[model samples]
Target: MDGKKQNKKGTGVKVALIAIFMIICLGVGFIGGSLYPLFQTSIFTKDSLITDQLLSKANVISQYIKSFYLEDIDQEEIESYTYRGMVAGLGDPYSAYYTKDEYEKMMESLEGSYCGIGVLCQKDEETGDVIVLNPFKKGSAYEAGIRAGDRITKIEGESVKDQDLNSIVAQIKGEEGTKVTLTVYQQSTEKEKEFIVERRETENETVTYELLSDKIGYIQVSEFDEVTANQFEEAVNELEEQGMEGLIIDLRNNGGGVVTTAQKMLDRLLPKCLLAYTEDKNGTREEYWAEDDEKFTKPLVLLVNGQSASASELFSGAVRDYEIGTIVGTTTFGKGIVQSIYPLKDGSALKLTVAKYYTPNGVCIHGKGIEPDVEVELPKAFRNSLDVPKEKDTQLQKGIEILKEKMQK
Candidate 1:
């Protein structure tokens, strides 16, 4: 009877242990099954939640505006504004988004060929009125009685008052064979006159050269564009043929244009040295060097002023750093940032500031202009006088004087 009781007690203990083990396994399986669906959902959805949230909010706002706006709105313009506003929010003055038309017009301008009534216009600093710098002598504007010193009042009968100069200029540019009407007030006549000028393809006048004196050549580079380097070479070669012993490069008031054109010009002037280098946001440096062995060895003088900028600063800075030429005038305009244009798929573009450039000696002229070796300021009274004699243009006279001195050396 004692053995039988012991065996029954031991068997009961073993059965209790097995029951607890089965309960534990069931509990674990139940919990895992409950969470597996949730885990799968989170894995697939969490990564895109933020993107979905933003797009949902934008869609809601767009729908609300379209449904409750005061009047019918242009959805296309609204979409364009979104892009423009996004770029504007960056707070970079040089970063901009251009429409198809704007991009094409700008490219044409850079290419140094465009269809427009050939007249250079600028807003008068004091009057805030659009003034004609000059009508191209070979263009229809000149043939249509437009002249320098005329004030532009209207384009195509739309008053240009309170409009930006850039917009007005764009309005004047169009496809070849188009006609643009301009109403202008000529100071010579003291009356408003209208002219219907035909737009035609014309070469931009980027470089103008003349013989300042015997053996002294003067070349004025208005801006660096597609044709600038080639035009400059032609002028220099012609001057050399004329027994030119020295050269004066007038870059005064030249707001910079194409950077490559400036580089090409530097290659001709610099003697196998680093022309310039640019540093991007990634801390990568791109160095430009002069590959040409032949260079202009004659005495060279570069003229600059407060309006000289961008590529102008590059050209003058490199020349100054290399001791290749003497800069004569007031300080430059001090724009050292370089812009790169990226074209969009829809014929538009983004012109953004990509890098900051430094001179050959690693001097960054971002906010500080390159100082001239000889500082000479023109008098305010004679600043815009087209007929100002050589003796009166103090800055030009200084440049001539410096070039003559360099030639003697």
Candidate 2:
């Protein structure tokens, strides 16, 4: 079976999104249960809480690895004797202390821009289907046949059901030119079939626009990054100069980028309305205001899907609430929590959940995602994708139909 593996460079994704503190995994909820009381703040400092048992375990592990392990152990590889003991002592699978290099890698992902498969992917909680949010025309996944709403149930032989999103990403990403197999479930047939996808480099952050006959303009936003707001602004200005009327802001499969950038886009779109709101601790709140009057007041249609999350969720929530545009597609990724990266005193950092972002309607889409006015789910069979479809894309056809009606109006 042949399937295309989407390329993902471990660079620009916000690992700890503010999705209400989606942290510590669904595991290791407590540290050593009863033993944790022995190492509480009252008894021990935050650093040295390990018992002698842990130290002995670390020594045994180190000696065994050095003498009998298959791989060679480097002398400088160890952090500190205390650190080794700490890992052994924690007894919590979820809690981990990263080395400096690992810590830096962890922090670099928050900018939300990456060079890989141009599609935003998310696991459907109900079906465990891997759905694409949006697709970049130039990326390999788009070229392969991954569509905005295609659900993947199996990666090779591994069932993706209940697997974490990170695990799915790891299975899909690899060195360029490698292929991964997937059993995609199309909405038409509702039966799973296998397909192999080869990995390739995916570069994004380029907002392209085109005149779609007369005053209608098509704007494809690849991904939101540090400069997306500015880039989209320029694109809007050019389209307006060309006498743009209906604007199609394609955010399908857009896993979301920076909140500030999304806020910038909202500022450009909603104009004077309350674009977005975030709440911090103790009733503290921050509201993002529009930068100026709305740029294009024409009928706008936002394309979204299950992969639309974080910043994109914020944008869609505001648009739907303000009635600024028609949000077309399936329900969006329910990620309402906001996370702010806190730089720790040590070289490592703490990516803690900071606040909850609510849409203008005071709706929280963290666990419950946003529902589109028009619901167009893909049938479980017959090549369902926004990329190059083996059959037809009901979602795209519906969007175009809705946009056409809006244009006629």
Candidate 3:
């Protein structure tokens, strides 16, 4: 009789707990129902609603992939692809999502240094061939007999035909002291050979300057990297020390890089004035300026071509607007927009088109390139040549001629 009484007590406690749980759940439901209208009206905006739908669709697709996919799935790769796709959906060609490795490589390029064989290359658009533009004299590639104008046909015994240029270059670059083999086709000799090159830390020479005839300084800028401004200033100062009376800045085939580097270079050349300005989607204007501490008051000539874009155009546009230099060669490549890299906590990055930049005179060159004061086309014979003779470079000749005329004044 005592045992039966204890069992009844235990059953009463269990029933009490169940009743309390149900009451709490009912209270929660009542509170949630009361707040539903508030949430619908304030929290769930149109954009958030659309985002919810997108997330729901993504979840459905992910579940199907997980449940019925034929092969093993890489969750990390899927997440990366999702991030890339999100950025690519914006439909802007200049914007992109970069993985950790890609972001690191990009930073290295912008910093103007890397561990590689030290050969600059470009992809031929028409032929889909990777051609060596320059092999640094002290680099391993140059030491191994690689020369400019040679076509890179294969990397590490794999054919690079129609391969992405970045991938090919990545294959060529490896850990320091590692060996990379390259098969090069020399068009001049009509010969093909394999080169065993060892990778090492190499610095990019973005600015090359020399004193030309009649005390005129000639500086060729390949790209505006982080170290470019300092190099350019040093070059200009050295040229001035050598009695440089006029200057010619060659921006031919120079695809732009860091925008601030161009601004810094302009700061050294221009006086106190508004350099350029950018306007974002909200019409918020940000301006760049050049102080009057230093200026190049001598005759200046800027040579630009169809491939001169972005920061190159910025420099050219500023020079033209200020009336400090005469712009020669063809019109610029017309990229007036600016891209800002947003770094994430995961070591990845997103480059987005942030704003449209304009010259000091408020001229936007997007889709409408900066016209040269004197337009000169490259001769057909020199167009295909990697190294055109100085006398045969019609556009450069025109620039020199204009600088001489200005100097005489």
TM-score of each: 0.73, 0.59, 0.74
Taking the tens digit of each residue's C-alpha lDDT, what string does model 3 give over 1-409?
0000000111000110000000000101110001111112335566553487788999999999989999999988998899878877897655667788876654443232235787656555445556675677778888898886787788888987644344455567656777888888986788999889888876567789999998899999877655679999999999999999999999876656666778889999987888888887999887878867688899999988766666788899899998999998877767677655566666776766777878999999876678889888777766645577889888878888888998999
Query: Which residue pairs in candidate 1 have backbone atoms (N, alpha carbon, C) closer than 3 angstroms, thus clashing?
Result: none
Give the top-scoring candidate (TM-score).
3
lDDT tens string, model 2, 95-135? 33444554453333222322234555644544566665455
Of the candidates shown, which would achieve the greatest lDDT relative to the real structure? Answer: 3
Pairwise lDDT winner, candidates 1 and 2:
1
lDDT by candidate, in order shown: 0.66, 0.58, 0.69
By the lDDT metric, which is better: model 1 or model 3? 3
Question: Model 3: clashing residue pairs?
Answer: none
Give candidate 2 misplaced runs (Cα > 4 Å): 1-97, 107-204, 213-215, 382-391
lDDT of 1 by residue, 330-395 (tens): 787666776555677677666566678888899988767788998876776655443346777787
Q: Clashes in each model (backbone N, CA, C under 3 Å)?
A: 0, 35, 0
Model 2, C-alpha of 301: deviation from truth (Å): 1.2
